[model samples]
Target: MKRTLVVGVDGSPESRAAADWAAREAVRRDLPLRVVHAWLWQPLAYPLAQNRDAEARLAEDILKETEGDLSHRYPGLTLTAEVLAELPVPALLRAAEDAEMLALGTRGHGALAGFLLGSYGQQVIAAAKCPVVSVRSAHGRPVALPEQGEVVVGQQGGVADSSEVLRFAFEAAAAADAPLRAVRAWNSPPVYGYSLGPMWSADQFGGLEPYEKAALEQALEPWRLKYPEVEVVEHVEQGGGGHVLLTAASDARLLVVGRRVRESSVGVRVGSVAHAVLHHSVCPVAVVPHP
Candidate 1:
């Protein structure tokens, strides 16, 4: 069976926006969409607890409401809804195992707000097997993916670390018929520490922007060949990665970034760039895990 696109909803405005975004993505990918809600049972004695059946009914109601809205919006789109009797993190991760991608609602405030505010969202994104898209609403409504604005993706390191990010960005741009903006940021080398013989050429003493731009183009050449139809705009700037990506994606419909999958006894790491963009990006952000 084909993997479906899964989206988690808790009836918040941000979640509703995610559902809207996911539905459109499903249409674009020609994939089935699954709308899910995790319903963890709490004891009746708990302060905010209701009866078990009432809680279950409420969970089902949330799914029903979202399903109804999305079904009405996309008449021909294949959609399904379910309520999982488990906690949010594991439940969504399990659902994502068989999914093409997972979409979640995120707030556009400080680093500690929305689904991403705590460990819940972080856990799901770090541990999931597929790409996770975090979406935010604008002015109390879902921001529609722009047709003209480019689909921006941050490229770092090399093709090995950023292949998945580039692939997702190219496919998204192709699907939306929009341009793809590939951004690479760099910082100048320290003035005193280095031998200039091997690292710097005679002409490079003046500046390194040309070399940085060339490296960026080299990293993107293969992708450009593969996606010949995608109009790619290469952007190389001198600054921090997160700041440069956010600025380049200011008018973007979607921002794609790579998260290196790391296993640690302490916890999963979302990386500095991904973390920064997740906290502040104005458009929807997709975190693609890569080696």
Candidate 2:
């Protein structure tokens, strides 16, 4: 099947907001949009077929309504809706395999009290093959990023194979005609004091600041050249990765981060930094899967 921007939707306002966000992104990328709703029917003691029919109808209604609204708002946008009789996470993951990106909605930032990520949304973010954007629902409406805001990207501060994430961030900024804020963090190793070497004074460690700044600049140089129109802002600071990114993304239209795809003995492994931003960012968070 042709690639499209896929959105996972339910009847909730959060999911509706996700669908709306997907529509806008699809328009930006000039791609088709697909809305997917997954449903399951619990077995009843009698008339199991009736229960299944009711569940299917409800799922269909959700898809149809979302499709209609999006099509009306965005005329001539290629659209398709599907109702999958499978588990939410697995179905969304399957849909994501062929999608340019998968977007879903959440209640709010997890750092706030009484805010928790739905199990299915968390599972899809951890395992989806493509980039996944998580948006929050508030005021019973779709949360839209400010049109004039910049796109913030978190990096590891050196020139490495973080090209996929960087490219996505740059392209997004270029598309929106907004600045790209590249944020990198630096910190002393956790074992600094316990190391064999003698303790170093603050003055002795002050020289590292320039090195970190140079690394961030070098890492962003080529991308800057490639997208000359995009204004680049580099922020190199000494702090925890997650906190640095969270603060940088506070005024961003979208926060982009990389996720290295790895198969561990336990299961899929997501970096702590990406996991934290996914849960806490106020704006939409895009987790780009990298090899």
Candidate 3:
């Protein structure tokens, strides 16, 4: 399936880096690239209902110049450019309506990106209709190579949340010619709270681990048959679910996650954990719908 990728460029060094990245990515997937540069009419300056006469023109000129440069630089790649008269964040979000993925460059050059998602990138990711990627270097840096081989996607087991995360994970893995690591987390019951009536009986505890393991296998069975090409790495681990997912993400090019609060096409809200992972994951995070 050919995916449409939209990338934002404000002509900043980082944005240029994003352009390069987007070019390479589009080529890898045989997808088209749409480059967007946004301009807004400044609302007011102090007590005055402001003047955007000069600023708007300048912004448009910059976008046009940058678009021309990108066209020359990525000659073989399919490209499209647009200059928006709307705010960068909202404009990008609107553009994303038809895009499969939205890409951006991290705007800050300091040591604090951990706490700062650039104003434009932040707003777009918070409510974007599709997955968003914020690049670290947009200009002279080398574009990130597409996933080398089968990419690995994390899967939690048995729990409803895990089931939801798996569908997106497997679909993405297949798209990238990657593998799916169907992960199931397990842990011993708390030592102090073990004697809760009949629930903690020796017989129940004795068969618990084996039963849970079977359940996990059962959950992944259909997926295994459906996507025989996706190398399935079933990881049954003893640790926290989030932590296990993070560890598995180390070698993955992209991690696909799902939100619990599924929305209609218009009101999609990527759930909190998925949001948190996006901010913290070392690789790109793709938030998928699992409702």
Local distance difference test values of all predictions, in order:
0.83, 0.80, 0.63
Residue pairs with backbone atoms closer than 3 Å in model 3 (clashes): 16-138, 17-138, 17-139, 18-138, 150-178, 151-178
In model 2, what are the clashing residue pairs, if there are any? none
Top candidate by TM-score = 1
Better of 1 and 3 by TM-score: 1
Count steric clashes of candidate 3.
Answer: 6
Q: Is candidate 1 or candidate 2 better by lDDT?
A: 1
Write one digit per residue (lDDT tens) for candidate 1, span 1-291. 878999988877778888989999999988999998887765755476356776677678878999999999999899999988777888999999989899988742321123323357778888888999998666655566554698999988766777888888898998888899999998866777456672575247455677777767878888899889999998989999999999999899999999888887877888899999987888989999988
- Please give, for residues 67-101, the per-residue lDDT of candidate 2 as tens digits: 99999999978999998777777888998998889
Ranking by lDDT: 1, 2, 3
Give the Cα-based TM-score of candidate 2 against the true structure. 0.85
- Stretches of candidate 3 off by over 4 Å are 1-3, 47-76, 106-122, 134-150, 156-168, 184-223, 262-272
Q: Over the stretch 204-264, how does candidate 3's per-residue lDDT look in tens digits?
A: 6466566556667777777777778888777777776567666777666766665444455
Runs off by more than 4 Å, candidate 2 = 44-50, 107-117, 138-144, 190-206
Give candidate 1's whole-model lDDT: 0.83
TM-scores across all candidates?
0.89, 0.85, 0.68
